[model samples]
Structure formats: C-alpha cells, structure tokens
Target: MADPAALSPLAELARRNDPDRFLCALFAPPAQREVLFLLIAFNHELARARQAASNSMTALIRLQWWRDAVEEAATSAAPRRHEVATPLAAALREGRLDAATLQGMIDAREVEMEEDIPSLPALLAYLRGSAGGFAVAAGRTLGAGPEHLAGLQALGAAFGMAALLRGIPAQAMQGRSLLPADLLAERNLTPSDAARDPRQPGTAEVVRQLAGEGQRLLAEGRARAKGLPRAALAAALPARLAARDLARLASTANDPAQPPPPRGLGDRVAVIWGGLVGRG
Candidate 1:
C-alpha cells in the first residue's frame, strides 16, 4: 500500500482534473506517474469551478482565496495550511519551477471569476484559465524550457477548447448559451433553435457543425504542436484524441440506429491509438 502522507498537494490537484481515468488505451502516463498528476488535476478543477459559476461575485471570492493561497506558498519556505497552494509551493521547492507560472495560474483563475466573455475573440481571451495558466504549470513539469512552454500553450488551448465544447449542451439547456452566439446566428441557428433536444435533428445538426469547427481548430493546433517539447507534447496529445473522437461522435446520425459516442475507457484508447489523435 502507498503511504497517504507520502503524496504531496500537487497529487491532490491531479484528482481535481480526473487524470486517472482515460477513455482509450492510446496515450497516458504510466501508472507510476499517475500519482504525480495531482497538481495539474487540481488546477483543472479550480479552473472549471470558476468557469461554471454563473455569478461574478462568487467567482471573485473563490479566486481571491486561491490567489492568497498561491501567494502564501510562494513567499514561505514551509508548507502553509492551504490545500492546493501548499502542495504547489512544495512542488516548486522540489523542482526549479517559475514564479511567473504560479502568478499566472492565479491571475487566469481570477479573470474567469467574472462571466462576461461572450464572443469567439473574447472566449479566446477568457482562456487564460487553462492555456495561459497551465502552459506555465506544464513547463514546470517538462524541463521548463521556452519551446516546452510554447508547446504547452498550444496544447493547453486545444485541451481547453474540448472542455468548452462539452459545455454547449449544458449551456443550451440552461438558455444561457456559449456556442459563439454570432457564429450560431450566422449558421442560421437561433439560440432557441440550438437548445432543442439532442434527439431532435436540428439540434443534432448544430452539434455536427460545431463539432466540425472544433476539429478544424484542433487540426490547426495539432499542426503547430509537432516538434514541441516532448513533455508538453505528452500533455497535449490526449486532448487531440478527445477532439477527434468527439467530432466523429457528433458527425454520426442522431437516429436510434446509431449509438452515441463511446463514454467508456476502451473507446478512448482506441481513438487515440487508431490515428484519430492527430486527425482533423
């Protein structure tokens, strides 16, 4: 049995991102490395929390606390009582991590606490949460070089976009949509029209088109990702697979004869390994 205390706060962070689970057998860290994923996972969770909140005030409060915790860890040599922050500081002590990354992570989360990002361009700006912040964190894990950092930024953007796409269904249901409202309007889809049930053909068509756009973005990002830092490449490849599989699933007919995309681990691995990882 592993000693619970032997694990650090960063490990706890990985759990926040559900890093242990993979859809397919394609690309993943070895089991031994699984324990090291806590910090990345935790950062993902905090980012998600900030994004999901409907209220700016609530988001601001949560971000302020996280920011304070990060600051606390940066200055003090010892572990502070804060959960995510303490382990982060501990990780830095063990490794030659950057000060800017830590501050960037906090700042990214802080900005997302407010919910005003509505357009495609604005959405790109709002992505400091995963792309900008995690790019720094990812560099820390992958030898902390400039190339690695740059790769992680592109990788992080691809990963963040995958999650953003998932929220479309949920957002549609809530009537507070995020499908690049202008884009949807241009596609002849009113906000009211896209929110219709998934079983309906219209909604399914919208998903198909959106999924296509997502794949296009992933393709462009993946092309840029080649020759990136190996460590950063490791981080980004999984999302590439995710985007491919999701696009395939969305492209399928919404009819009962065709099943929806795989929600299981096996399908995920197959997609990643079967050349879908980098395919647009």
Candidate 2:
C-alpha cells in the first residue's frame, strides 16, 4: 500500500484548488477517493499551466514535462519524485487507468495555451478530449467496464461545456476566449469585444446557446445514467452542479461579464442528493 502521509499533499491540493471535484470524490468509495483526488489535482495542475508559465512555449514545455512524467509512470516500476507524480505513479501502477486518455487530456491543454479561437467543432473536440477524457479515466478508476466508456465520455463533455460557459468571465478577464470564433462571427462579435465587454449585443445569445447545448448534453448523459456501473456514479456526481449552473447561466439577466456566484449550501445539498439518487 502507498503511504497515506505522502498522499496528503494531493488531497489538500484538490480540496483547495478544485473543490467541486473534491466534493464529488467524497461520494466515491473510501478506498478509491484518494486516487480520485490525486487525479483531479493532476488535472488542476495541467489546466493552470498557461497561467503559470511565462509564455506559450513555456506552457508547452511544462505540459510536455507532465506528458513525459505520465508516460514514465505508466511504464516504470519506480515512482517520480514530485508530489503529484508520486501518487499518480501509484494509481497508474494499479492498472485501472488509461494512460492514453490521460495523455490526451494533457494534449488538449495545448489549445488553451493558444491565442486563436477555434471553431465550434474544434472547441467541442477540445472539451471532449480534456474533460471527456478525464471522465473516462475517472469511470475506469471507479471500476467501470469498457462498455461504460461512451456514457462517461458524454457525461464528461456535458460537464466540460458547462464549465467552459461558467468560466467565460474569468477567461475574458485574462483576454482569452473559449467561445467559438464562428459563433462570434455570426453575432458580429469579436474575441476582443467579449474580453472588453461581455455585455455587448449578442453576447447573451452566445452564452444562452452554449448553455443550452450544455444542458442538452447533460440530459443526454443523464438518460444513460441508470446503465452506468454503480461505482462509476460517484465519479459523475459533479454533473449535478454542472446542470444547476448551466440552468442558472441560461437564465441570468445580469451582466454576463460577472463571474457566476459560488455554489451555495442548498446547491451543495442538491449535489449530494443527486449523487445519492444516481441522477448525476
């Protein structure tokens, strides 16, 4: 068994930096929860690579390092020295993970590091690669079989799209845009306009459209929930929050420039309830 003490840093990282996933992990089997936290913490590190680096090249270099680390951990008996890498190696060694899917998640971050906005198809592909890939890996970790992979991927894409919509304000503030360029063009809008003022004409429509798409995807995933492996349910728990937030975003009449408020106590309760019912 791995040292519990050595895994503490990863647990703390997930709790502090990715509370949504941290909460979702609480619903997982106790023995598997730590590994889930380790996985999510690794994701957080990858997702923040751009902001943490000095430039795009630096970000690429950082991502490459993680890519190499994951590959090494997948094939080697010895563990890496870093905090995230160590537990991650242990998880991989257990033989429950798909290293290719995890590698795809890392590669997806490359799109985020670029200034150019992708088309809608390209954007969805990126989400499917990063978020969808994460979902598949998490489901696998939860003992889901090969048959459950498609459902997990759909669930992950739904959650990812909702997350992207939720992040618009913050991404805009950083002068980054995740909204598809074609959609923006259709609205006679530009990425700069969104960055400068998200409340401008047609922006709400763009948000509404994306949120609606997310909700649709969420519903589609939920339709297949009953067929998912029982253990996989906990890994999908965050979908409840994603559904709630997407609905809220779709209906908000206030400035879209503002970040959505944090999930409140009632929202948390709903998430737990949804998880318990296997509806998420």
Best by lDDT: 2
Residue 32 CA displacement from its true place in model 1, Å: 9.6
Per-model C-alpha lDDT, please?
Answer: 0.51, 0.80
Model 1 agreement with the true structure over 90-202: per-residue lDDT tens digits: 66665544556666666666545433334566555545345545644654554435544554565455556556555555654555444454555566665555555434454
Error of 1 at 60 (Å): 1.1
lDDT of 2 by residue, 25-121 (tens): 7778878888888889889989889988879999999999889888887574577788888878777777756688789999888998877565878
After TM-score superposition, what is the CA distance of residue 198 in candidate 2 from its true location, in Å? Answer: 0.9
Largest TM-score belongs to which candidate?
2
